[model samples]
Target: MKRPAGMSNQALEFIRTASTKASWQEKIILLEFVSGLRMPDIVASEFDLSPVMKNEYTRLLIERDSGKPIDLIIGKKPFLDFEVNIEDGVFIPRPETEELVENTLIRLPKDPQIIVEIGTGTGVISLALARKFKDARIFSTDISSRAVALAKRNAEHLGLSDAINFFEADLIHFSGSEILKGKVNLLISNPPYIPSSRIPHLDDEVRLYDPPLALDGMDDGCSVVRRILDLSIDYLSPDGLVSLEIDGLIEKPLNSYLSQSTLEFKKGVDIRGNLRFLYASLHENSFSIQ
Candidate 1:
């Protein structure tokens, strides 16, 4: 195959060899490695291709062949308009999660004062919220110390450190919960919602590289969702909204569970039209687990 003009010989060779094992999208991973250009920039032809060191090109191919995700290989992933540093064991933010952020934004009250985010893996959701709601005080928690530290670093990088408080705690169990209780305007999460039994069936990119702590949702996949709902009863203001990213397959079971709560619930689909997000607001009636 003739090398596309402006493409370096090394890049062409990398694509040819890497294409053997990689899908067309995976083949695009070479642009990230060689030019540091994201898919959008590449699609627009806005970047100049440069020669990659032979040794580095060979090393990247080895990593790619080993089934390492390109985001991990590059040490960062794009979220919305910014990039967040990531490493192995941290859940990489997904396009669906970006949709989750947008969905939450439309539902938020103007001048939302307090926001709480659970399972802030790379802090992308909280960071995006902080950027949008400059006056809102946001608190985010992650069970992994590494995740918390990385998120703090991302916040510092984006000059949003003051807007968000990063905590190394399980969902909503951090030190600031006392102050946030009954005052939060929005409580949002993209918690683990995949059934424990399905973990092994996930793609190797997910099952092997992503942390189980961020994926496994215990039995029937609503364990964390249920916990978040139960805990929201204490933290959410009477008008506070709860937004979550959930498995599309669990809508029936989740609605059954939500039926027992005092929250008024609505569900939305992703761009693919799968039920993927849940939005809820507390009612005047008291919450109960039943």
Candidate 2:
């Protein structure tokens, strides 16, 4: 739909600059993204927005001018079969990661004992696992304290507080793997896999607003993958499988890491059909092909 008559291109440009470039519904969509308030409710309400809501909206507009993701302002993001709260500075789950989760879910054992998820941002994977495997115990960890708290709240609200445990620790350094030990039947993660040099070139919402701790994967983007693979060696059950999200560009390097490990892997394609997941299980033979 074209802009209304007499509305100068400059005015339309300003609106487009502030939000998306939708033709007719941009304004309404912007309202939905920022506040999650229905158009009818907002139009009919006689009560005023709470002082907190007013301040949040003001800050949201300022953030928008600078290109923060609207999901950050809306305080939530929908992930495979669920909605996860996304607080400021916490990483929002991307649609591409859903492919990783789906592939893992399909491979899960019907009566698995324990599952461990590293870098459990917003508990999207762990919570999803809980819903699928009600008898399985899940343990999830994140280096960010804020992410841990938010994930915990999400689990509680979903009535999964007892089924999942949230931990504040980095998988790269955590050594208490003996708690689950060799009983962990599955390991999963969507860790930082963005090459460090490429991070600065990402969109402002990703480079500026998405937490750096969750996006920077060091020089080659396989640093976290390497560390987590070593971590899984100690925690996985004999038949345990590990699944991870990775950058398609680093497939060779990532496969190299798999070559040195004792795990056999099957690659996965993402929503865009690019190979972006590595699902592996223990292989008795050492030094497999890259």
Candidate 3:
């Protein structure tokens, strides 16, 4: 491939060599390195005009060639309008999860008094909610201590430390559960929904880098989801809502389970048109389905 006008020979040569062994979005990754911009901004800017820090850019190229995700290589990821600090072993938030947050925002009550988030990996969902509902007392929990710590830091960095309460616990098992029971206005999560058997088939960057605790959903992938649903019965308010990001393959079984439960359920597709989001509310206060 002919080198773009302003790209250095070193960068061009590295891309040429790495292309033989690995497949990546070369242009986007390179733009991120040179311009210090997130993917969305990188796409709009002229890459050739962006100044590249040669040594750091070379190091990033080497890391990318070794199959590390660019987010990890850079140690940060953009979610919504803010960037969150990420660490090794914590599950990186995906674009789909951002969509989950936006959809939840639309369906949530105009002014929720209390909100609970299960499996708050990176705390992006809770952070967004705290920003949107400034007065809402938001409780976010994650089983991984590292994730909880990192999430707390992210909150502090965004000046949201006072708005969210981060804790280390599995699902809704935190010490403050008594305070949340029957009072949670909204409960949301992008929990681990990938089946155990499918983990090996995931991309190398995801399977090798992301922690298993954030990926495995056990035998059928609905274990965590089921637990969350059961817990919601006790935790959710009379008019509360439950929104979750789920794997499309388990829709039928989950649908069957929801049918038997007291919550009125609805499912929606992601940007790709796959059924990926599930929303439920107590039958007494059904969703104003849009």
Candidate 4:
């Protein structure tokens, strides 16, 4: 048996066969992962997979073949300017949500006293706000205690723990103090908006790995969105804005909701140019949707 660094090819063939569906290149990726060594570091070097490394390589390949998201496999996802660790059952951040944050930043007040984010998975939106408005009181809420705890950890890691507050609430029936009602200068959310019907059709990587709590939005995919809009009617301060990340399927219905509201309506597009966000402000004047 030919050997490089005392590793037998016949032994390598067993690892390859054990991977089931992973290709040769994928095996190399898995090898590099457990080796903690990049391709540049491994080139022309005496490379041998340690026992622990070999075990981990096989484990990761098995998980990968079983449809786990690559980001979750690595346990980290990059959003905007920083990488956030992913916990089991927490939704990984997506690029569309980053576009939502960018749009919100553009529309925010110069110095908002209070900002509230609903369904703040992993604190991505809130963390961005904390960095943008250093003095602002940022309030983030999630229905899942586990998600809230994980998000808090991410905030603390970024040194924004003292700058932001995280809370767990079932918003549908939440009964908090008036501080959030009519006092919030800005309200933002990337609520669950994927229609229940569409969930089964989602890619296995998402349907099988991402938390349903962060994806399902009932029948039309705007049930939670409607609730948020109702809350904003009373919660948003005068002249304040309500910004949301929405499914493309909800645009027409959302437009109708915005048209009836006392707040002025503004639409935004994501990086791919899809109508992915809706902005509303307390106003009487009319403006065309852009």
TM per model? 0.88, 0.81, 0.86, 0.84
Lowest-sum lDDT 10-residue window in model 4:
281-290
Looking at model 2, residue 51 earns an lDDT score of: 54
Tens digit of per-residue lDDT, candidate 4, span 30-130: 66667787756665566666777768877898898998766788777888998788878888889998998887777765457888889987899999889
lDDT of each: 0.83, 0.76, 0.82, 0.79
The per-prediction tally of clashing pairs is: 0, 0, 0, 0
With a 3 Å backbone cut-off (N, CA, C), the pairs that clash in candidate 4 are none
Top model number, TM-score: 1
Give per-residue CA lDDT, model 3, range 1-290, as digits (tens): 66555555655565566444345465456646566667655334443332345555556677777898878877889999988988898999999999998888788755788999988878899998898899999999999999999999999999999999888999888885887889998999988888899999999999999999898988888889999999998988888999999988777668778778877787888899998899987764447555
TM-score of 3: 0.86
Q: What is the Cα-based lDDT of residue 220 in candidate 2?
A: 88
Give the least accurate 10-residue stretch of model 2, judged by summed lDDT: 281-290
Residues 1-290 of candidate 1: C-alpha lDDT, one tens digit per residue: 77555565655665677545656566666556665667665545534444554456557767777888888987889999999999988999999999999878877655578999999999999999999989988999999998999999999999999999999999888775787788888899999999988999999889999999999998889999999988888888877888899977677679789888877777888999998988877763322211
lDDT score, residue 138, model 4? 84
Between prediction 1 and prediction 2, the one with superior lDDT is 1
**Which residue pairs overlap in candidate 1's backbone?**
none
